[model samples]
Target: MLYRVSVSFHKNYLTIKNDSIEIGIMEKPVKGKANAVIVKQIAKHLGVSKSKVRIIAGEKSQDKIIEVMS
Candidate 1:
């Protein structure tokens, strides 16, 4: 499955609506830290492993595209 994600910093939250997700992450967008958290959170929410979640686009931006393998 693929999802369109909008990320927010300094807050911790995860919401799913249709094909898009709104994620409020506490980590800063530096050195892949925030991205890693994004993957982890989404995986947990979807009942999948971190390895099954991948950010395929928008690594440096708030909006991202992620792929999850079932």
Candidate 2:
């Protein structure tokens, strides 16, 4: 599955809305810390391994494209 994810820093939560996902991450975007948490959170939510979820685009921006392999 592919998703367009919008990231925000408020709380730790992930919400799936249609083809988009709204993510509220607690970790700061430092040295990929927030990205790591995003991957982990998505993987956990989908009941998949961390390796299965990947950020295909926008690694340095608030909006990201994510690809998930089953």
Candidate 3:
């Protein structure tokens, strides 16, 4: 399954509305920390492994295309 997610960083809390996912993380965007958290959270939310979720595009942008392998 593939999902399109619109992400917002530095929010007060993490939320998922429709195809959008807002995450609140203290980690900076440097060194791919924030992206890591996004993948982990998405995997947990979808009941999948972290390895199963991959960001196919928009790696440095808020709008991302994710591929989820079942």
Candidate 4:
């Protein structure tokens, strides 16, 4: 099971590692790769499980609509 998430990614990663990927955004758009970090942060703040958040759409756009499910 999975869920869709929408967010903007900015460079928050201090160092590149295989196991750890960092992403962050300020209330606005930032230039960076849209990865799991952003999704995780949003999900956590939303009080939802990480597994419930996934990037189902809008790979290169700002306005993204995510589907929430059980």
Candidate 5:
């Protein structure tokens, strides 16, 4: 499955709205911390492992496209 997520960093909470997954990360978007958090959260949300989740695009942007392998 593939998902397009709109990430909002530094938010108070995480939210899932419609087809988009919103994540809140305390860590800044430095050293791929936010990206790692995004992958982890998505994997948890979909009941999958982190290795099964990958960011195929927009690694350095707020909008990201992720691929989830089942």
Candidate 6:
């Protein structure tokens, strides 16, 4: 399924809020500069594989699209 996420990127953290669903989490992106680190951290929290989470769109922008497998 596809999940639409509204993201807020901070200097050291990222908060994603989904209004349509009931999910809540404010996460730190990473200490370093790799985008992969943020992705991995979120995937781990969601109990999904790293490969299953992707910034399908808006990699550079705040709002993003994420696909989670069944």
lDDT of each: 0.95, 0.96, 0.79, 0.48, 0.83, 0.55
Clashing pairs in 6: none
Candidate 1, residue 23: how far the Cα is off, in Å: 0.3
Summarize candidate 5's per-residue lDDT along 1-70 as a digit string, tens digits. Answer: 7778888866745677666676777778998988998888888878999999999999999889889899
The alpha-carbon deviation from the true structure for residue 16 of candidate 1, after best TM-score superposition, in angstroms, is 0.4
Measured by TM-score, how close is model 6 to the native structure?
0.56
Compared with the true structure, model 3 gives a TM-score of: 0.79
User: Ranking by TM-score, best first?
Assistant: 1, 2, 5, 3, 6, 4
Write model 4 residue lDDT over 1-70, tens digit each, in one string. 3333334344342222342323345434444344445565656655788777666666566544444344
Error of 5 at 27 (Å): 1.5
Provide the TM-score for each candidate, comma-separated: 0.97, 0.96, 0.79, 0.45, 0.85, 0.56
The lDDT of model 3 is 0.79
Please provide, for model 1 over 1-70, each residue's C-alpha lDDT reduced to its tens digit, 9 standing for 90 to 100: 8999999888889999998999999898889999999999999999999999999999999999999999
- Give the least accurate 10-residue stretch of model 5, judged by summed lDDT: 12-21
Clashing pairs in 2: none
Q: Can you tell me which runs of candidate 1 are displaced by over 4 Å?
A: none
- lDDT of prediction 1: 0.95
Which candidate leads in TM-score?
1
Q: Where does candidate 2 have its weakest 10-residue lDDT segment?
A: 10-19
lDDT of 2 by residue, 8-59 (tens): 9978788998989999999999999999999999999999999999999999
Runs in model 6 lying further than 4 Å from the true structure: 11-34
Which residue segments of model 5 deviate by more than 4 Å?
none
Instruction: Please give the RMSD to the true structure for each candidate, in Å.
Output: 0.6, 0.7, 2.0, 10.4, 1.5, 5.2
Give the C-alpha miss distance for residue 32 in model 6, angstroms: 10
The positional error of residue 43 in candidate 4, measured at the CA in angstroms, is 1.0
Better of 1 and 3 by lDDT: 1
* Deviation from native of the Cα of residue 67 in model 3, angstroms: 0.5
Clash counts for all predictions: 0, 0, 0, 0, 0, 0
Please, what are the lDDT tens digits per residue for candidate 3 over residues 1-70? Answer: 6777777666635667666665666567887887898888888988999999999998898788888899
